[model samples]
Each structure stands twice: as structure tokens, then as C-alpha cells.
Target chain A: MMHALILPLLFPLFAGAALLLGHRLPLPAKRGFSLLATLALVPVALWLLLLAGDGQLRLYAMGDWQPPFGIVLLLDRLSALLLLLNAVLASFAMLYACRGDDERGPNFHALFQFQLLGINGAFLTGDLFNLFVFFEILLISSYTLLLHGQGPARVRSGIHYVVLNLLGSALFLVGVSLLYGLLGTLNMADLAVRVAEMDAGSAPLVAAAGYLLLIVFGLKAAILPLHFWLPRAYAAATAPVAALFAIMTKVGLYAILRVFTLIYGSEAGPLANMVSDWLWPLALVTLAVGVFGALASRGLQTTIGHLVVVSVGTLLAGLALGSQAGLAAALYYLLHTTLVSGGLFLLADLIARQRGALGALLVSAPALRQPLLLGLVFFAGAISVVGLPPFSGFFGKLMLLQAVPPGPDALLFWPVLLVGGLGMLIALSRTGSLIFWRAEGEPVAERADGLRLLAAVGLLLGSVLLVLLARPIIAYLQATAAQLLDLQPYLAIIRGGEA
Target chain B: MEAVLAVTLGVMVTCGVYLILRARVFPVVVGLTLISYAVNLFIFSMGRLATGAPAVIGKSASHVDPLPQALVLTAIVIGFAMTAFVVVLALRGLGELKTDHVDGQEPRE
Candidate 1:
């Protein structure tokens, strides 16, 4: 099963190509095939997770070429966890898409698979340039996916998203090229080694490149100032696309964590802990801004979009702590937020569909066809998202708060995070009452689709499952964080390969 | 030669940036194309300016770094595809909203 390391990337690649070629096939067949491909990833990701659980860094050099010269995909605890997350989220999103969303545009299933391929490749790749390529793959697929349904709002947002990300891509190449020029290698491990040994004379240039990369990743992650694009783009995306996009921002956070910890980490003299000072203040403001946006938003989808930004802010805060506990807390919270936010997006879509012409706007509309069930799901999601007790969100936030050592940073983080949760609580409750309680008219639409509800509830249940399996998951994440902070194994992998 | 290449890149990027800031989609697309061109040149130059050296080894005593050439190739292809997509998207936006303005409406005069 050593070859299974490449399966995550290949399954999607082949499946996407097949779907594109067979685009004329019946929708059921395409759905069945796409669902099968996506479902298969779960176990594959699980197996990869089990493999990575053993604490050994697994490297799959493309075409059997060695690292520092050839491309390599690496699997460790962090990548495995993210792969599993993406697989699970993609599975649910794919399930939801099967209920007619895939038919909205040409090649939705193919684009989705390509998106997964890019995301999976990104998590697995250890080469900087390869990461850039994967980013483009995911991004291009995302641009099409955003415009999948073809609406005025989507085009407007799509233009901004495409143009901005194109610039981001240019910046990404510039940064990668700068690093390659300075270090003469694109392999991440080799770069880490070289960056550490780099003299002070070239420090400023490397720092510029590092910060440039940060800006690009920050744009992807939607950190505060660069975050204006997110709510519009995500809100304008179709439901399943929006659900899948919950993992997209995490990819940015993941890159930040990966590059900062691995390359510019403690061992990199003169460049050590460079992102910490910048990440801290930005995270606080992002949290505050996201909450404010959520509170002010008129539509449910946009509210959830802002909530995604809030999650980004919270996760960045956990990462900003710059400790093993902090990373572990952030990873756990990442699992919770990605799933629940995805569920909320799907749920919001369901609500929008039932509102007749009202369509996700927060105004009082006709009651939903299945108000009781949806309201229950909404209540549950709200509880989890608001960081209330007994759900994964509460525990995730608790872990993050506890992870923060008592310091000025804690003082800043505790209030901003707690208050942000309170703000979410207010926003969600207002939305729920307006949609479910304050309604005076009859239910507008027929009973909701079983598959769609299942898809949404299935993902929302992920939060509960996280709470159930909190012990082992948190333990694994702790080890992952420890592994990330401990650069020796990663650096040693290159040395081992060179020998 | 290096100074000239650097100046050209700077000029291209400046033009790209200026055009991108415009409210119109056509200008924005043109700007993006320019920027991608500048970025491609920048990546190519990262290999340093070498006129006569062969890219492949064994044919010459000193070979130019072939890596950035490969990198630039990949970047160009991706950039080309993106430009095509954005252009089509711009046309679609024009059809749907009946405006070339990025905001999907004519700015109030």
C-alpha cells in the first residue's frame, strides 16, 4: 500500500478526466461514478492517516527522481489529517451536488474532482514550485466552479476572484523564483536547510520573499485586509461549491503553517519566528472584522461567508501562539469549523430553496416545508458554531484558549475569540428566528430532498463525531503539531534521500 | 542586458498594475495579461542572463540553469489558460449584465 500515497492525487485526476470525456453520459451515471471516486478517497485517506500515524515521514518522489532536483510528495501527520478532512468534506459536498447541483453547468463533477486533486496534491507535495502548481490547479477549478450556475452575482464576484487570484499567482511565482534563486533548489526540505544556514547578508531578500509568500497565502486565507474578496465569492458560489470551499481557506492556513514552521522556523537564524509578530495582530483584527461582517450581513449565505472568515481568524490566532499546544488546538478547531461551516452553507441553501422568491435573505419569509427538522439542524449547528457546550466547537475553542499561555497574547486572544463567538451566537439566532419563528405565511416549497438533507446533516454530524472521538483525534493532532515544530525529521528525510 | 531586462519588467508590471486598477473588464484583462508577461520574464531572469550557454549538460562546459526555463514554461501555460478563462468570463459578464464595467453597472457620471 506504499503506492497508495499517490492514489489521492491520481484517483481524482483520472476520475476528472474520465468525467470530462464522458460528459455526454447520463447524469445518474456521472453522479454514481463521481460519488464512487469521492467516497473511495475516505478510506484511502484513512489508510494514509494510519500510515502517517506511525510518525514516519513518507516521501513519494515523482518518477522515482530524488529530492532537491525532482518533485516529491510527502505524507506526515499534518498532510494525512488534512487529506482525511478534504476527503470527508469532498464526499459530503459531492453527495449534495448529486441532487441536481452538478447539472447546473458543464463538468461540475469533473471540476470538483480536479479541485480535490489540486487540494490533495497541495497537502501532499513537499516542493515549493509543486505547491504553486497545485494552488493553480485548485484555483482554476474553483473559478469555474464559482461560476458554475452562471448568475449576475457570480460573474461580478468571479471577476474579482479571478483577477485577484491571477495577481496572487504572479506573486506566488515571483516569491518561489526568488527563493529558488537564493537557495538554488525548490525542494522544501532543502530550502529549510539552506535558509537556516543562509548568511545575514542575504537575509533581507529572503525576508522579502518570505513576506511576499505570506501576502499571497494571506490573500488565499483571506486574512483581514485581503479578506474582502471571500464573503462575496463564497456567498455567490453554489451551495456544494461553497461547502467544498470551507476547506479552501484552510489550505492557505496550512501553507502558512507549513512554510513558516518548516522553513522559517526556529532553526533559521535571523529569520526565526518571522510570521508570529505579524500573524498575532492580524488575527485579532480579522476575528473582530469577521464578526462585525457577520453581524451586519443581510443574507444567510453572506453571514456564513463572514463566519468562514471568523473561523480563519480564530485558526490563525491558534497558530499565532506559535507553540505545539497552539498548533494542536488550531488543527482540532480546523476540523470543527470546516465541517460545521460547510454544513451551514448546505443548510442555508436548503432554506433558500424553500423560501420561494425570498431566497436566503434574512427577512421573514414563508416557513420551510420541513421546519422542525431543519430548525433542529440549524439549532445544533448554531450551538456548535457558537462554541456552546457539548459540541466540538466548544471543546475546540476551549483547547485553543487553554493552549494560550498566560500572557498579553492570551489577554488579546481570549476576549476577541469569546466575543466573536458571542457575535456569531447573536447573528445565527437572529437568522433562525427570522426564518423559522417570525414567519407568518404558509410553507412555500415542497418537502426537502432526502439526499440533500442527508448531505447537510451528515457534515453537521461531523462536529458531533469530533466530540465523540475527541481523545484520539486531539492526541493525533498534538503529535502532528509536535512533529511540525520538530524540524529534525523533515530535514533528515532529505539527508536520508541524499545518502 | 540585465538592466534593460529589469527595466522592461518594471515597466510592464507598472502598466499591468495601472490597467488593473481601472473599472473596465477589458482593461483589467489586458492588465492581467501584461502582469503575467512581466512575471514570466521575472521568473526567467531568476536563472540569470546567459546568452550562449546551452540549457542541457554535456554539450557545453557551462550550462544555463534549465530549471527556471522549465518553470517559466509551466507558468506561461497556466497564465495563458487563465487569461483565456478570464476573457470568456468577461464576455459572459458583458452578455449577462450588459456592461463592461467590473461592478456590473455604469458608474454614475
Candidate 2:
């Protein structure tokens, strides 16, 4: 049990350290080592997913210390799903990196593994301060990775990304400190128990802590007002990095859902509805702003960057509904968006490579050498992104709409989602023609590398696989959502006094 | 001790925010360091302000809870690392763009 519990963290940490040591090796050797390690995590993650899929929360107390006294890694269905998601993205991103991006800078593979370690640790840790530590680990590594294959544009955006996240980290620390001062416990399960036991008088302090946490997480997740840094930073990152980042934003959302639901959830007086009330309005505006930004974006990657913002908005809006139905929809949408957005980022990179000087700019380029193949792939990617039928995106939106109960807020949500898709359709069409259809001169692009094409196509297939396996997948997600909302099992098993 | 520490933290944070909002990169770095200092103190204060409390496990009637101290120590190390990384990044930015402006430079006419 301890082996399975600690394996996820140890695997990446050791691999990353080894990669750092072997930095003097040839590029191919380095890439191969990193690739094998990342791929190996998939099965480990899957086995754990199956183990936890039964809805039991497996708590691994580190150093054999009991709860509230030591750090712990808690595995539940939701954590398993996210670990699997991270593994899938990490594998594909590794494949994409091999096409040329890995050689863009030194120690790319090491930093990538470190980033994954931080992400997986953040997902699994049961201590709030430990989460803070993991968040820093991820952010520090991201700072370096963001600056990889350094360019003036990358550096320019990297500065803003670093400063904003530093501020967010400070806020996170402050929030955690506030909670500790008030409650004297840092273990999440213990905090939940204490919160439930608190009287009405302490509600205001919890609310302060809750709002501070919301602000920090809101910044990380790029909620509307705090979202100014994402487009520039994401657009400037290398393709594989950007693709993996599709899950990075989800980390913030995951933290929000996990903490808010488990600890400060409605079981805690006065803290029950704090985040939801503001979340709906903010999310609606986020969706609107994201769509408009996408429409205004001049480059293909920037447009995809804004599309990421749109997906975050969509997921949060569903979460704001605060029903089991809404959570189920959000979970499904998370899976859908991560894959499609990841594929689109890789697709944009492939398109840029083949398009020459036009370089993913929204303008006429000479005809691509392999138009039919690339055209077909891009069309599929665009359709999936806009949530057309027969793709996971379509089903995701359908579920969200179904989950919304008949209420006046439905008027606001329905229009934004529908209109946002419309805006997305127009943007997609315009960009599609600008690159693939407006061919006029000689065929300027060299044929793309076979491996890169295979990776991109495989991602699109992964999305399709979601469609094919919709039955079991949605069932799994619904179960995951159900487990997430029920705080009792998590509370009982890990509480300081209960056991 | 409590009121004095609170006022000090408030002053540090206010000044830090001001420096962080500056246009140049260096002051922003300093601002970040300042804010981190304030946050470090805030975390330390969670253990309460204790006088004549044993850092050891000696049988002092009210030993200052040493957990937050250990946490703040770790946080300080992490904070220093962050400051160092940003400083190098800011220097590189200045060298590359030939400007210290955070936005790199004005749009070329």
C-alpha cells in the first residue's frame, strides 16, 4: 500500500533528478530516458485509478505518522481520474516534444518531469501547506520551462507570468496562515472536521480565509479579473509545453473544487455559498471575454490560448450551478477540453512548421505540400474545438446544458454558451480558410515529420475514443462527481479524532 | 508584540505593493522580496508571540508551537530561491531587450 501510494511522487522525482545528472548525454539518449519514464507512469496511474475507482479514499500517511501530525497522500476516484489525465497528457506531450521542441533548450526533459511531479503531488497531498509547497515547485519549474528556447517574446511574457504567480503564491501563503491561526490545523480532513464544529461567530473568519483562497486560486485558474497574464504567456510557450499546460489551469480548478467542496462546503456555516454566488457571474463574463479575445486574436496560437480561457469559464460556470448534475457535467467537460485544447496546440505547431513565413498568422499562405491530410486534421481539430457533433466537445456542452435546472440564471448561461459557440464557429471558419483554403502561390511548405503528425493525429483519436467510450466514461465521471460531493467518507476516514 | 508586528506587516505589504507596481523590473523584484518577508512573518506569527519559550522540548509551561517556525524556515528557503530566479530572469530580460522596462519597450512607430 505504501509503495503504491508513494510510487507516483518518487517516480518523477528520481527520474527528474537522474535526467538532471545525465544532462551531458546526447540529446537522443536524454529524450529516450525521459520518454520512457513518462510513459511508464501511465500504467502506474491506471492501476491506482482502478484501485481507487471503487470509491474508497486510500490515505497514505508519510513517515508512518498519524493524521494532523504528518503529510499524507490521499487517493480517491477524483484524484485517480486527474492522475490518469496528467499521465495521458504527459505521454502525448513527450511524443510531440521529440519532433523538435526538446532540443530547443537544455534540461527540457528534466524540467518537464519536475513539473509533472509537482502537479501529481499537488493532486495527491492532503495537507494544505503541502499543497502550497507543491504549487511552488510547479511554478518554479514552469518559470524555467516557460523561458525555454528563449526569445524576446517568450522572455517578455515570462516576466509577467512570474510576477503574477509570485503574488498569487503570497496570497496562498497568507490564506493558509489565516486558516492556521484560526483553527490550528493544516491537514485538510482535520480542517473539514473543525470547520463543521465551528460556531456562527467563526464563520466570518472562515469566510475571509475562504475568499483569500478563492482569490489566490482564482488567479491561478485565470478567472476573469485576474486573467490578464494567460494569453501572452501561453501563446509564447513552446507547443508541447502549451499542450501540457492545458492541464495546468485545471489544477487550479481542481484545487478549488476539492477544497471548497470538502472543507468550506455547505456543512460549514456561512461558508457554504460564498464561492458559488460570485462564481456564476464571474464565469459568464469570463466566457464572454474569452470568446471576444479569441475573435480578436491575430495568430492561431493566441486564438487557441483564448479558447483555453473559454473552456475554463465554461467549466467554472457549470461548477457554479453547485448540483451533482452540474459537477458531473463539469467533470466530463474537463476531460473533453483538456484533450481538444491539447490537440489544437500541437496542431497549431504542426501548421506553423509547414506554413513557412506566414507562420500561423491569420493570412494567405502558399499551399501546403500535403493539403488533404493536413487539411483533414485541421478541420477535425477545428470541429472538435467548436463542439460539433460526434466529438467529445459536443457531448460535453450537451451535458452542461442538461445539468442546468430551470431557473432565471439559465437565461444568462444559455445565451453565453450558445453565443460563445457561435463566436467560436466564426473564428474557426475564418482561420481555417485563411490557412488551408486561401492557397494561391507555389507549394512552399516542406512535408511535416511523420512522428509529429502521428502524435497530433493520435491526440485527435484520443478525443474520438472519449466519444466511442462515452458510456463507461460518463459513468466513471458521474461516479467521480458523486464521490467528490459527498464529504462524509473523506471526513470520517482521515479525521484526527474519528479514527 | 502582537500589535507592533501587525502594523509592521501592514507597512511592509503596502510598500511592497507600491514597488511591485513600478514600471522598472528591479523594483518589482525588490517588491516581491518585501512581500515575501511580510508573508514569512505572518506565517511565523501563527505560532503566536512567545517570550521565554523553549525552542527545545524542555518542559516550559507554554512552549511556543514550533511547527509554524519549521514551516516558515522552509518557506524562507523557497522564497529565496524564487527571488534569485526572478532576479536572473529580470537581468536576462534587460540584457536582451536593452531596456529595464517590464513590458520590454514601447511599440515601434
Candidate 3:
């Protein structure tokens, strides 16, 4: 049964390695291998999700070693949820990229698999140090992927992106070592136990370590002061890669959510709710900046970039609410944001191509082919993005706004959720009308890539599906949030037979 | 010995930060390399200052923790790979953009 846990990590590794070994193979073979590998992950993730659906937590110990001594991969509702989300997005990205995006680079298929491996490993690992290792894996793969087409813009952004993450990785090692030095264990469950019994004298140092780790997570999650690297990098990346990169930020959010609740929640005295205090103000600011940047930016790709930042801001703010209601709402919001954002990136690419010289700018340059159908596609994503009713974003925003209790945070969270969302709605309308509503010049006769448009539509359908499934999904997320608040089972599974 | 090592690591990181904050790409890369070295040593120090002892432990023997040593070794290899990647990325950016400043600005003559 535990083999299910290891399979997600290993399958991708082997798939990537296989692709690498068959470098001399034709495109169809490489593409087939990559697609098969990604498609296989969905079922595995679903199986794991089913196993963990009823709050089951499974721990797989590598080399038969016990916790605190050897690496362990954990599967719970949260990891399972994220793994499924990742697989779904990877499948879409693969389908979209299959239409020649992969041909831009020889090693695209291999790197794609490796990126999945890294993402899955990051989601699954229960040890703090292991998280750092997988982070490096993902970062390295992303570094190459962002430079996939090898353009100057990508290279510039890649340089900044790599440098920033490298610094973050450095801090990660420092924090991990500090925590290990203090607690004598790198296993998160063990650290939770040790942290509970921590001496008063060492509390400050432990808090500092927690703060350092949060800073690292913040950088990855694009919390302000550490977010400059993201917009440009996402904007500079090729569309398909940018679409895939949408899920990458959520990995950081997952880490933050995991580490905060597990290692420092009520289990660890004094440090409980440590980062949440600071997260509230920081996240609110991040949300504001993201929305404002969106309204101010004219380019469609840049708008998508800032829109991502907005999602991060809103999700992080919900998380900082530090209530079960808030977390469940955030999780719900996170789901649609990923789907809608990824769809929009692909949509933006198609629009840019259709507009020819204008390239996704919010100006009337030429009429796009299939303007009405594509206009509806943009409307689908736009309404969801702007948090209008009957869409996933509306459901998520409503839940989030209603979830915050009547208190100090509600004061801030309410206004930001309302006004920031309003900002998005206005920005979307302006951009939509500018490009789609008015046709001021001759239509650019770029041949429509039917497959790409269909893929973008498929992404839009996913957002609609989220709305249709909102009740059941939100119910599941509420349970997942409750499970996160309950760390006892996770600890017991890691401690094994003694429990 | 611990004090000496701590100070050395601190100095390396300080110098690395100063270099990283510079406008040039080359300095930033060098800074990243230096910072990585400090980080590697920091991870090694988690096992405590390894005195004159081989990294082998008998059933009850008092030996230094090899875990962090192994972790540092991994970090070193990754750091090297990252440094190489960044240097190449910087060089490519410079070649294409006609500038070597980290933000791609042409330096004043």
C-alpha cells in the first residue's frame, strides 16, 4: 500500500531518465513517453487521494529506516490534493505543449518529467531537509524550462530567478541546519514533538528559525519584498511554461501551510501562530500590490503575471486568517485560481499570436480570428478571475469573505477581498473591451491553431467544472482543513508502532 | 574552534552579501558562490566541529554525526551546479543584451 506513495516520486524519475536515455528517438516516441508518464500520475494521485480522503495518513520509510533517521514520504489529504492538482495541470500543460512547444528544446520531455518528479517529491516529503532537496530539483528543472526557447528575455529573467532561488536555498539550508541543531532531528513530526518540549531559553532561537523558514517560503510564494523575481520571470517565460509555472507558486503556499500548521501550530507552544501574525499584514499588502499592478499594467501577459500575484495575495491572506473556515476557503480559492490562471496564460498566448504585432497588449491592433468564440472563452476566464457569481472564483471569494469572523482581521480582509476583486473586474473589462470589443484595424490573418484553442477552451471548462462541483469540493476542503488542524495522526504514523 | 569557525562563516556571508548587492552580474555570481560555501560550512557545523576523528562509528563509539557531513556534500555539489548555471546564464544575458549589469543596464563609460 505504501508503494503507492513511493510510486508517484519514482515513476516520474524513471520516466525522465528513460526519456533522457532515448535521446536519439523520434519526437513521437519522446512525446508519447512524456504524455504517458504524466497521464499515469493522475490515477496514482487519485488513488492516493482516495486512500487519504477519509483522513488516512500514510508514511513510507525509505530503506526500512525509522523516522528521524531516514527519509520519509507522507501522504495525507493535503499532499494528495496537491499531487492531484499538479498532475491535472501537468496533463493540460503536456497537451498544450504537444502542439510543437516541446520541439523548441530537445530535452523538453525529460525536463518536464523531472519537474513533475520534483513537484511530487516536494509535496510528499515529510522531512524538512528533504523538502530543501526537492526544492533544488524543482528549481534546477524550472531554471532550464524557463530558458526552454533560449531567448534573451528568458535568459535575463532566468538569471534573476535562479539567483533569487539560490539565495532562498541557501537560507533554507541554514534554517534546516538550525532547526536540526536545536531539536536533533530533521523529521517534521519529530521536530513537532521536540518543539513542544522546548526550553524557555531556546524559544527565541526556535522562533527565529521558524521566521527564517517562513521568509524562505515567502520568497517562493511571492510574498512582497521577495516577489519582484516572479512577475518578470513569469512574463518572460514562454506561454506553456508560464501556464505550468502557475502551479509552482502554490507549492510554496503548500509548504507554508504544511510547515506552519504541523511544526508550529498548537503542538509547539509559544511558536504556535508565529508566522500567521506577520503573514496577515504582509499578505494583505501583497494582495493590494498585485491587484493594483494588474490595473496599471497594459500588456496582457503582464496582466496575467500580476493576476497570479493577486491570487497568491488573496490565498495567503485567507491562510493568515488562521481559522479553519479561512483555510478551507483558501484551499477552494487556490483550486480555481490555478485552473483559471493556467488557462489564461494559454489563452493569452493564442490571443497574442492572433493579434500579430500587438502581442497581447490591451489595445486594438487587429481583429482576432474567431473573435466571438474566443471572446466567450476570455469571458469565461474573465468572470471567474474577477470573482463573479456562478463561477469558481465567486464561490471561493464568497466563502472567504464570509469565513472571516467579526474581528480585527475582517476589517482589513473584507475591504481587500471586495475592492481588490473590484479592481480585477474593472481591469478585465478594460482589457477585454480594448482587445476584443473593438476592432479598429485589419484582422491579422495568422492561421488559427485549432488544437491550442481547444486546449485553452478545455482549461475554461475546468473552471466551470469547479463551480459545478463547488459544494462537494468545498466540503472535502473543510475536512482537509480539519485534518490539518489535527496533527496527532500524522505524528503517530511517523512514530510508527509506539503509537 | 567553534568560535573561529562561526566567525569565518559569518565573514564569508557578509562579504558574499556585499558582493551580491553589487550591480554587476559577475560580482553577484561570485557572491552566490561565496554564500554557498558559507552555507555548506554552516550545514557541516550542525554535526558539531569535527575534531580529529574518522567518520566511522562502532556500536557504542563516540563519533561525529556523519548525517550533516553527507548533507553538506550534497549541498556542495548542488551549489557548484547552480553557480555554473548562473555564470552561463549571466554570460548569455550579457552577450545578448549588450550589457553585464545585473539588471541589464549599460554601465556608464
| Runs with alpha carbons beyond 4 Å of true place in candidate 2 | A496-499, B107-109
Give the C-alpha lDDT of model 1: 0.94
Q: Residues A1-499, candidate 3, lDDT per residue (tens digit)?
A: 3688998998889999999999899999888889999999999999999999978778898997977788899888889999998898888888889888998878998998999998999999999989998999999999999999887778878888988999999999999999988888899888888888899898998888898899899999999978888888888887878888999999999999999999998788888878888888888899999998899987888898999999999999888887889999999999889988998999988888888877887877788876887788898899988889878899899888998888887887889878998999888888989888787776766665888887777776787898788778888999999999987886676466556
> For every candidate, how close is chain A to the native chain A in TM-score?
0.99, 0.98, 0.98
Off by over 4 Å in 1: none
Q: TM-score of chain A for candidate 2?
A: 0.98
Q: Which ten residues in a row have the lowest lDDT in candidate 1 chain A?
A: A490-499
TM-score for all predictions? 0.99, 0.98, 0.97
**What is the clash tally of candidate 3?**
0
- Residue-level lDDT of model 1, residues B1-109, one tens digit each, is 9899989999999999999989799999999999999999999999988989989998988889999999999999999999999999999999999999988889999
TM-score of 2: 0.98
Query: lDDT score, residue A455, model 1?
Result: 97
Local accuracy of candidate 2 as per-residue lDDT tens digits, A1-499: 4569778788899999999998999889988889998998899999999998888989898988888888889999888889989999889999999878998899999999999999999999999999999999899989999999998999999999999999999999899988998888899988888888887887798788888999988888888998888988888999899988889899999999988888887677657767898899999999999999999999999999999999999999988888888998898889889988988898888888777787888888778788888889989988887889888889989999989887888877888999999999998888888888897788877888888888788887877998999999899988988887788887886553454
Per-residue accuracy of model 1 over A202-301 as CA lDDT, tens digit each: 8999999999999999999999899999999999999999999999999999999999999999889999989999998999999999999999999999
DockQ of predicted candidate 2: 0.83
Most DockQ-accurate candidate: 1
Tell me the TM-score that candidate 1 gets on chain A alone: 0.99
